[model samples]
Target chain A: MPLPTLAESAIIVGAEADDWRAAVRLAGRALFESGATLPGYSDEMIRMIDEHGPYVVIAPGLALAHARPGPDVLADGLAVVTLATPVVFGHPHNDPVSVVLGLAIKSAETHLETVAELANVFNDSSAISRLTTAASVAEIQEILGNAS
Target chain B: MKIVAICGSGIGSSGILKVNAERVLKRLELEADVTAAHLSSLSSDAADAQVILTSAEFVDAIGPTNADVIVIENYFDTEELARKLEAALG
Candidate 1:
């Protein structure tokens, strides 16, 4: 299966959040508002980071936050939150993350394609730049489309 | 040589590491196969690999193996990954 396009409702541009947790919560709220996942899904993401580390800061200025699939996820979903101000994840190499992509997948078996696609998107320097300053959901979607 | 990039889940950060690893190998003109795996699923069988790259948090989980486990603090820094890979594979 190919990676699904991020839903417009799940994209939050210029989100205001003082820290990484609040930024994650804002992204989680988008997923929740879209009925993609249950409440507290964002908290679960934070829990994973707290327990382990900032491994989710996959790239410089980018974080792909997620947790295991369970009751928290109603369906496979993705959310993009571009912060007005960057927040630090305390990752040695990748700090001050400005883009947080929230993922809520139904299962591990079904997430390979989406994850692969996301990796491809994040790997592109130009795409990352566009996403960092994307003014609207449409612009973000266009960037994803171009990358795909 | 075979290299595997491990993360909490095979699909996420590991994927990023794998791509960066591939780029590093290509730039160095080194011919090797690189793959990604979940930290929980990695085992002694991975001893066949030349190197195993992952975050520092997972080093203990990887345990003892014939393969050299390189703890990468950042998965996205291809330059750092290349530097480390050269030092190891050379």
Candidate 2:
């Protein structure tokens, strides 16, 4: 499960603003509007974020938000967003997040391997840059393909 | 060693906690079979586990866990958690 396999270019965006909540909402919009999500996904995602405060900030600017798959996951896939400017989600040590990775797994088990792959991906400096600057979906896919 | 991670649902945060716990145990050079399950099924699961790791909310979620419950605020802090688990198991 490479990042691009789960990441779609259509969802990527460049941000110039500073509000992190808006950034999350921006990512949420991509998830919802792209028809990449199941019904009620946007609300569930917002609720989960409001409660958890970006629980999966794997590194400084990288955050992965995943909610339980009840009625939110339209497919057995994922939706992603790369922030144009970094925004803070109120994490204790790390303040700003530049890339928001939203995942909707149809089943709890479907994401295990992807999560493991993400763990390794988040550890690299160069790889994160490639993903952060990825301008198109094919480029994003290429990043994942080259990550190995 | 058999380890059981009990949480509200068998699949959400508890599942991530289970993954971190396994990573910690592995780092500590301990061999253990780990499983994450909902609080509702604790009795059967607790019967075989050598160690039980859970959050502070155990009191409300499933009454009191019968095994040595290691209360942790966040499961992702592997270093502190590994140390806590080592002490509990020791």
Candidate 3:
């Protein structure tokens, strides 16, 4: 199945965050604003990073923030936040993530499928840069395979 | 062969790892059943797997396993995954 449809409201462009925690929190806030997760879900995402190190920096300049399937997830949704200034997450290879994706998954299977789908988009290194430099929400939506 | 991609929750980064591994494996002209799983289910999910793919952060947490646990540097970098996977299973 296709990844959760990202709403326009959930997209934040040219967002400013002081650090990785704030950057991730912004993505979680987008998820919350999009009606995909509860307000506390952002903290859970932060907690995961605090516990596990910066493995969430899956690729150069990219970070996908999320937690396990939990009650906080109201729906399977994805949020995108482009940082105006990148922040380091202490990753050895991939550091200073500018793109933070907050994902709220209601189930393990479907969310995994979405990841596969998302990989197709993120696999292109240019697309990742575009996301970081995107000035408009529509550009991000387009880059992420969302027309709207 | 069986491969497992593991993460804290198994849904986010691990899922990305699983997909990237499948792509690399296909490019390498190799076939393996790859699954994404959480750290909690490592024992059962990766029991029979020949290789386990994950980031360095989880290496200690993975503990001891018969399978070779490969610490992936970048989940989206096919170059890194291809090099490591080819070196491991070439």
Candidate 4:
């Protein structure tokens, strides 16, 4: 099955997040609000980072925060949160991320298409730049819609 | 040659690395098969790869392998990756 696109309700523009944890929370909140994930999903993401490291900061200015699929994931979901001020993930590379893309997958094998599409979007420098400056959820949706 | 990109989950950051690696390989005129796998699966998945590219954090987790492991500081920079691939594959 094809992965879902960036939901309008799951897009947070100009979000106020003081640190990476707050940024991830803002992104995870969108997923929860959209009924894609259960509560505590955000905390789990942070915990994973703390245990593993900052590998989630996939690109120079972007992060794709996620935890393992479990009861917390109601369905496969994607959320995008653009921070008003970029926060550092303490990564030697890809620090001070301005956008966080939260993902909730039902299973690892089921979300390859979604992750591939997301990687394509992120690989495009212009798309990442536009996403960073996107003013509203509608704008972000339009950008993603156009990409698809 | 076979190459694999690895990450903690294999679906997230490693996917990005895999894409970048493909681009770099194409530009370098190198012929290789590239795959992405989770850190947990690297022991089995990386056994056949000639090279394994991933973040520095996973170097120790990957342990000792026959493949030449390259620690990429930046996954987004395909130019640097191309250079490194040339150096490794040439």
i-RMS values of the candidates, in order?
2.5, 5.2, 1.0, 1.9
Per-chain TM-score of chain A in candidate 4 equals 0.93
Please give, for residues A42-86, the per-residue lDDT of candidate 4 as tens digits. 988888788789888867888889888888889889898998899
* Residue pairs in candidate 1 whose N, alpha carbon or C atoms collide under 3 angstroms: none
Lowest lDDT sum, 10 consecutive residues, model 4 chain A, at: A1-10
lDDT tens digits by residue: candidate 1, A1-148: 5556577778899988988889989889988887789878999888878877888887778888888778999988888899989999888877888999888878776676676677566656666668889998889888776322
Question: What DockQ does every candidate get?
Answer: 0.41, 0.18, 0.84, 0.54
Which is superior by TM-score, 2 or 3? 3
Worst 10 residues of 1 chain A by lDDT: A119-128
For candidate 3 chain B, the 10 contiguous residues with the lowest summed lDDT are B71-80
What local lDDT does model 1 show for residue A91?
A: 86
Candidate 3, residues B5-62, lDDT tens digits: the string is 9899888899898888989889999989999998889999998999999989999999
lDDT of 2 by residue, B1-90 (tens): 788876554454455567777778788888888877656678888787777776554645455555677765544456657888899887
The DockQ-based CAPRI class assigned to model 3 is: high
Best by DockQ: 3
Report model 3's chain A TM-score. 0.97
Kindly report the docking quality category of candidate 2: incorrect
Shift in Å, residue A100, candidate 2: 0.5
Alpha carbon lDDT at A46, candidate 4: 87
Model 3 stretches astray by more than 4 angstroms: none
Of 1 and 4, the candidate ahead on TM-score is 4
